[model samples]
Target: MERELSRTLPHEPIRWLKEAGFGRVRLPREKGGDGASLPQLFELLAELAEADSNLPQALRAHFAFVEDRLNAPDGPERDRWFERFLDGELVGSGWTEIGGVKLGQVNTRVTPQADGWSLNGEKFYSTGSLFADWIDVYAERSDSGGPVIALVNVAQPGVERDDDWDGFGQRTTGSAPRVLLMRGSSRRTSMTLPSASATKLRSISMCCWRRWRGSAARCCETSARA
Candidate 1:
């Protein structure tokens, strides 16, 4: 999938993603996935990134898609709303904020309402948001406590998109700014997941070893043994 995506992405990976079941690997079995372990998925992501950074992103989109559904309460609501993601119908990420708001610096706020919740804030660098069915947004509490994630329906009424991702490279990502209004009934809850590690080491290791070593490998091996 990585090789294929590396060559075709910025153009055709989405179609392949839908067809190959790469989009459903993390989803529940009932929701059309193999339910693979995280280690396996992580290794796959490394390989995918080695092929093309974009591939890992599609993989992350798939991860977030299933994760959001699995995190939700199981019932007609969960089944009805999150089924498309398991089916590879949507793709996107929920990180990043406008105006250089770093992680733990969330400005988005989620307020409790009668039925569900209401969310209001602007988010940026949301990769693949243009093609996303929903976005996993994080908001800070003015009172106190940890950050909370809100599963926002971007297709719903009040959400606005400001796609301005015009990078020199990675031109196909379509990442941009988004403004979400709090008119819809949304699920406001915290997600239980670990933070990802630095990609630099993996990036460096792969870049170093990917090419054949006529003399470098021998010298390193001899030095280690000595």
Candidate 2:
């Protein structure tokens, strides 16, 4: 794992975690998950971070997605998602835009089309995206200008990710600049996430502080087998 980290992202370890059913730790066993408590999950993350801190960061969105779905209303929509989690699929993030875009502004927009929807824009600091099967996008409705969350499949032709996150220490975090073009018609309600970027500031900062101090590994896991 260390050797691979020198050349590229730790795909092996990430894959290993998925096959081990780590992403479903927060879920109930009845739902085909590990049914781990929140504290236990954090402890596991801390251990994982000690081995390779970049890993937990790469899986932040995946765990967050699981948590979000757990609170969703019980129904077919939620049940199908639980199945995906058990299948080891992962979700990444796409809520931020860099540059002078300002604090309260969003550049990504989702417009309605004859077939479905059109998602267009770029996102920076897209951590965990390189290995993501799906991207949780934050966008605005062109028609009503209301905020909405989008869950876009990464394999779609319209989606693109670049290996450009060269941050100081979190370089190999599977993070990259993501571009969503929606060349043709995309499905209705593509990868949508909350526009509550501001609300997460404090929490993100806390995690960063913990990471810097070599403790408090709070999220995600990996794929490669060692």
Candidate 3:
């Protein structure tokens, strides 16, 4: 599959996967997913990685976002995001920064205006942003300088996806840096997910991390047995 993917550069594997309902593998059965358990999801991911490593890496953020939404308290926000996922809209992330040692701390600024807010900053290692319908950017609130995650529409103004990834390999994963300049009214652009007191968020992160490590270990054990 990796060789096939390499031969088919610029192919739409994400779309193919989504069309096949791979995106909803972990979503609850009530929410139109297969209700796959964490171990099941990770095992599927590992298998996909064994076939084509870039496929799983490119879709990592999407899976993480799905997990976060699944773990979120039942509310309007959760419903809205889940509905979007069910609607076949892909969500990508742009959180890391250039020359930044700290993880999850972004230099992107989300400033408020009378109409809405403006997002201004550049992000590096923005994996899977280009192919996604929505981009979740980690930014600092201009008013309080607090960290926040803003969901921005990819088609909105001030968003640019550059194809300047100079990496020697995995070039088709769309992991290049990108820039976003979003300006809209509060109603349009205020979909911020607060992380200040994200106990649930932290729990979800740790859970996924453990599942990932366990999946790798299980794969190794299986290989040894084989």
Candidate 4:
């Protein structure tokens, strides 16, 4: 898998984004994807992480948000975002906050506008937002009511970005904090499970199993005939 990814990734972001098939790993088959399930998706993530942790972390974030966008119940909006994501035109997700809160808690607020919406808040641990064209910024429930998942186009005038990521590990992830200065159209929604930690555990276990089986296979393949 590492060899495959190294051959495919090319050490270039734009090329890898289009070639890796990472952005849509869990997308339904009907939507121009392989339609991987949770376990199978984990397998792929493990393989990719074994090659490069940052690679898989970014991939996991991308796909998790992709799944969220696809399932968000906003049919036209979902299709719009998903198509852009698949085409590598728009990268997605804003997974963290500057205040160190856990995922799913939002300090951001989305206000409805005459056209779409306005977003205001700071996000931390945004793994892919540095190069992302859009972000799924979560916010507190609006005073008007309904859900609070807002898909904000970061290229807009009010979006602000700060790539302040200098972590010891996963340096290549490009994780950072971004502040949304304006609101946008939003809806109540659930987030798909992140595959980072799970992918790590699965990679370790699979490596052990492969080593054990490899030893056995070697024994069988190089045995002396009686």
Candidate 5:
């Protein structure tokens, strides 16, 4: 138990979370999820982090996507995504980009293609992406120049991920990896999700709570094991 944090990713634990439907904890019970509230989700995350901080970190993006979908207007389109979550598919983050003025403001971009929009960008510190079925990429449309979230399938040839972290601690928080999406077709979420909604703000708060609580939880766990 005292060994250095495994250089290997916690594939088995992540698999357990998926099979147990932890990823869909935010969905309604009728929608085949636990239907947990945001506060409840944050509570569970703190507990999960207590056991293994990396677990909550790995799931950050997945939960965020769940919340996003929960906020979307209900329809068959939304139901399909709910079913995907019920089926244990996970979403990963692709929000952060390196360099400056790669575009007007955002580095990532989605350009129109004959088939659909192609997401082209390089993201750093792409936490949890390696374990994801899809990536929730933040990109701007080239034509309209508006921001959108591009839900990109991981199986496509255009997505690339590698663990390139050289930091001093937490070798495998499922973080600090790089993801490159090169002209990958995506399912776009328009910017209509209200940013000011007090309910939706819980998602952002949950992210903050995970970061602040995860380390202390891990420390306590290590001490208990000692």
Candidate 6:
């Protein structure tokens, strides 16, 4: 499938994947999804990667965001976000910056104002942002310098996306630099990960690694049987 589509540089496979209900594979059955287990999701991802490496890599943020939403406590926020996902909205990530800083540290600033808040930051390697309906940006709160994630509309004013990625390969992923500027007031919504502690984060990372390993093993077994 990827070989056939390789000739078209701007072709977005995600649209087809979403239409096939691949994006909602991890959501609960009650939430209009297949309720795929972690291993199942990773196995499907591995298969997709085997077909087109760039597709899986570009959609990594989207998969992670879906998992986050699924793990979120039952509330209006989770329900609303899940509904958006079911509606076929794609989300990209802008968590990493160009600087060689630590993983969790963010230089972007989000300041509260009289009317709302302001966001100012520059991000690099913003994978999938150009193709996404919404971009999740990670920044620091101006008052306390705490980490916060904000979901911003792709067409929001003062948001700039540059398709200047110079990589010799996977150029179709649209991994480029993005700038978000809020001169004075901008309506922004912010959220923090439930397990934001360093220890918890590390544990979660290990869990994900294990799940992927298990998925790979299962795939190998299935291939052997075939």
Per-residue CA lDDT of candidate 3, range 64-99, in tens?
778777876899888888777777788777777766
How high is the CA lDDT of each candidate model?
A: 0.56, 0.73, 0.72, 0.56, 0.73, 0.71
After superposing candidate 4, which stretches have Cα over 4 Å from the reference? Answer: 1-11, 69-75, 89-91, 100-105, 145-147, 167-169, 177-226
Task: List model 6 lDDT by residue over 1-226, tens digit each.
Answer: 4442553333457788878878788888999989999778777888887766667667767777777777667999889888888888888878776667786677887787876667777787777776777777777889988777777766667777777665554656667654333344456444453356532543574578557757777977999999
lDDT per residue for candidate 2 within 183-204, as digits (tens), equals 4457634544353553364356
TM-score of 6: 0.78
Error of 2 at 74 (Å): 0.9
Task: Provide TM-scores for the models.
Answer: 0.59, 0.82, 0.81, 0.63, 0.81, 0.78
Please give the lDDT score for candidate 6. 0.71
Ranking by TM-score: 2, 5, 3, 6, 4, 1
Clashes of each: 0, 23, 4, 11, 0, 0
Residue lDDT tens for model 4, 116-176: 5556677766666655666765555456543355566666766777755544545555464
Q: Which candidate gets the maximum TM-score versus the true structure?
A: 2
Local accuracy of candidate 5 as per-residue lDDT tens digits, 82-161: 99999999988877786654553677877877766677888866778878988877777788877677777778777787
Between 5 and 6, whose TM-score is larger?
A: 5
Candidate with better TM-score, 2 vs 3: 2
- After superposition on all CA atoms, how large is the RMSD of candidate 2? 6.0
How does candidate 2 fare on TM-score? 0.82
